[model samples]
Target: MKKNLLWLVVFCFSISAFGQAPKHTFKLGESDFLLDGKPFQIISGELHYPRVPKEAWRERMKMAKAMGLNTIGTYVFWNLHEPQKGKFDFSGNNNIAEFVKIAQQEGLWVILRPSPYVCAEWEFGGYPYWLQNEKGLVVRSTEKQYLEEYKKYIIEVGKQLAPLQINHGGNIIMVQVENEYGSYAADKNYLDINRKMFIEAGFDGLLYTCDPAADVKDGHLAGLLPAVNGIDNPAKIRKLVNENHDGKGPYFIAEWYPAWFDWWGTAHHTVPAEQYTKKLDSVLAAGISINMYMFHGGTTRDFMNGANYKDISPYEPQTSSYDYDAPLNEAGNATEKFRQFRSVIEKHLPAGQSLPAIPAAKPSMAIAPFKLNEQVALFNMLPQAVKNATPLTFEDLKQDYGYVLYRTTIKGGKQGELQLKQLRDYAIIFINQKRAGILDRRLNQNTLSLTLPEGDVQLDIFVENMGRVNFGKYLLENKKGITEQVTFAGTEVKNWSMYGFPFKNINSYTTKPSAIQGNGPTLQKGTFKINTVADTYLDMTDWGKGVVWVNGHNLGKYWAIGPQQTLYIPKEWLKKGNNDVAVLELLKNDQQILKAIDQPILNTLKKINVE
Candidate 1:
């Protein structure tokens, strides 16, 4: 009881020192944002709660406060909250309400971007994969089934966070309606439905919509404030906001990109601090509100990283590490850009006031290489196969993510081109239990030469859902695995057996590794002891393509196709004793050893299969 009293005392003291009243008002005025009826300039930074672990949310917020930011911006991912239909999870790292309350305790207000359709390079644009099962459901539209699911999700979010709004004695100052709807379509009716949903969910604070500069006019609602994204020109920002927002003057850059995200085959993107700090200074000089798209881009853990595709570009899957080269690195350590931006922001602070002290960098360690002695072949542990006349997609099998195997027998002596119609993503072909080429959707690889033997040969096509396209027009039909038929020698192959490997229970299948062998997917296990635990990167430089699990915590996917060579393992997932490591390598593993390195190799590249 005494501990509770002391904790309350510290919380009240922090709130008082931050000049936060129990109740406050935030609204858009004719020429400025009125906080307590006074002109207020929002100095904010973006940090997604799902990206960072729950244990480290407060430290990341402290980093934001130390960087002279007065506000925190976050996007609530629909998929992360509701992985299944009618079932929701707001606990653990998914606890966005706790995230916002922590921001308040850390002396920062919040700009909640709780749009159902968030395109942050997240899987399926933050839409739950189960939505694909809802036939005739068109996302970002006023479609009945889509809206019904959306309303349920948003109301749950509202129940968790709406009461936390600044008007309700909480810290959320503004809420975004829809995310970049103008870039997708020009339907105000669709956006209005989203607005009504937010309002009905009890989000009565200042409502706004954010879109790119070119799409600002198409996306913003007439009754709500419209915030421009991507552009930082002080004059153009004011001009665009005034033109679209009824000659108003509370100019805000909702997504000021200091750097860009990295795709699988591309080089890591970085923008020099000198390049954007100047623009940041100018934006602040004009007294415009700004939210740095990512003050700290944390790791996109698990299989949740997204992909991108359009009419012009090939299917490009995002790298697992979301270290956006921001002021803070993926581990929440301050970068040189952080210091440079802090210097620029210090000049704009009220006289005699100073930012909080920058926190010390988190400690990281390196572990000696360890061998994965035990192994289990994927084929040896296949679940009961579902038989079908034609190959089925991931959704058809009720599988959300991971790999699926399509097996059948093809007559011999007919060696010709083998093809998979509408291959969702990556696939590995095997004939008579021997590896026979690969097919990658990113490279539009669908056909390969096949040489059948004398007898009827067993055919196996293992397909993996690398990730769903989270942006552009192609996202509408992103059904993973073999979406269509398989043909050999121009004849449709039939009588297939489908096996799903969602890997939900990695331990159930891997508790006792076997002496399995073959050129198929293999689950390998390794163990290492640590004197102390800290943040580290599992070096996958020697491995091929697959996922890694440290103490059963998935570190996301890694491939030899260049760019991302290491998987980040947070210290919170580590302990001070023996830790188990598992790897599910799909292609090849010549060396059965792995390393826990201290540094990241995000920019390294191997031979990329695609042009």
Candidate 2:
């Protein structure tokens, strides 16, 4: 009874605004959105709930409302909500219903983009990693298994959100079909089924599909409203949309990219404020409905960060701070571009309409450098081994995030190209628990030549899921670790033991007195006292690349080779007393410490090309 009570309390607070379903009437016309026989142009801004802290959801919404936005668009991350198959989570910030309720309460409409395959550079394009394990399963296709799972997921989402839609007296005005489908494939059967499933799941309001202006022909489906993305020239965009869909109007630019997202080692992307204002002016003058792709781009945080891979480039994993170089900076602070865009928005409002005053920026403070004195080793906290003669994928072991260690006794050590077939991302190769060399999939550096001492050599290869490919055809094969057999001297050594170090129980890491002297990954722990708790950015300048957890909350990843070197630690996670801080440093295992900085270091462009 006590456990059940705890579960309910957690569920309720996580999605704090969850409530009873109510109904209204919302419909779509050829030229405009109608709210009870009136023309309504949806001026929206996209903001993912998972990316923002749950406690600040209302504040962000208020900011959006203040910025002249009538709608808040978001995508439902499948893996974030349902990490494991069969089991589902609609709790806390994961709860779209709660998020929508907050939007509604803030006098903002909702544009729910529940893309099961949301390729917003998210891991596996928002598909759960477990789906890869399903036998002969093909996602974003007409495959029965894929559809079945998609059906279950969409239906579950609908049960929670359909009632809250504007048609049902709630704030949600539009429901997006499979996100940007035109870019992925052009399967009418697949889209037809998707439309059927969404309705069956109970989304009885306006349903539409969005795609890049070029891909509209391939991705747009019949019986669904089609919208073009990223294009600013309203006339050209509409021309492109209509040429593909027989010229339907009341134009909507689904994802207007004011700026782009950041990847590790790349300079933070930004477009001049003048560029955005010019495009936005033309768009509003043409009377087009628009949703800024990310009016407020928040942090992706942790392993949830996704990657991009096309045959044209290397595997590019996104940085933790999704700042997007958007008008709203990483810390949710406004920039010069914000004011410029606000002026443009003010000019476009209807004769009698006006925007609310922009909210004041949130406060931040700097903390004195704190030392990470305690040490915890990964080797000490691993769970029981998933013994296997060969190797296994992350999905095969039913694991999602964190590092995986493949241990084996390399007999009569030989020197040659130690190759890993399709190594998912990055690997730290160790011979007898010491660093040998690194193998990264991004640079096509898959094999490392090593000189091994000839006794019974204990070979351990530690692989990090740099992040799964969220976009492109390579997504089908994003299984981490030495996926196939490791070859030494072009021979397959059989009968090896594999350890699954998924770090499922991160809190259980072994803490003991140790002469921490290895270059391998080290867990540095520390404690800091705080008389008052508030939001802070864990400055990663003093330390190297690693993940940080404060008071047991996974703050996210940090790399020295970064455009993003600070992780946002929300006040909700901090305490009034001493707060525990842990760092899992993978690059340099120096006994370094961290401090809290008032500002985030998001755009420190390191010029060394990652590829």
| True-vs-predicted CA distance for residue 155, candidate 2, Å | 1.3
Cα miss at 236, model 1 (Å)? Answer: 0.3
lDDT of 1 at 35: 94
Global lDDT of each candidate:
0.89, 0.80
TM-score of each: 0.95, 0.93
Residue pairs with backbone overlap in model 2: 14-92, 15-92, 23-168, 23-169, 24-167, 24-168, 24-169, 182-219, 242-247
| Candidate 1 lDDT score at position 362 | 89
Predicted candidate 1 versus true structure: per-residue lDDT over 1-611, tens digit per residue: 99999999998885653335448888888978999999899999999998898999999999998999999999999998999898899998899989999998999999999998889999999999989899999888888999999999999999898888887789999999999989999998888888999999989888999999999989988988889999999999999999997888799999999998998878889889999989999999999999998898898876888999988889999999999998999999999999999999999997798988999998999999887888888888889999999998999898988999999998897789999999989999998878888998888899999888988899999999988999878768889999989999999999999999998756777535456567888888879989998999998887889999888777888988768899989999999889988899988744588888999898987884321
**Could you tell me which residue pairs clash in candidate 1?**
none
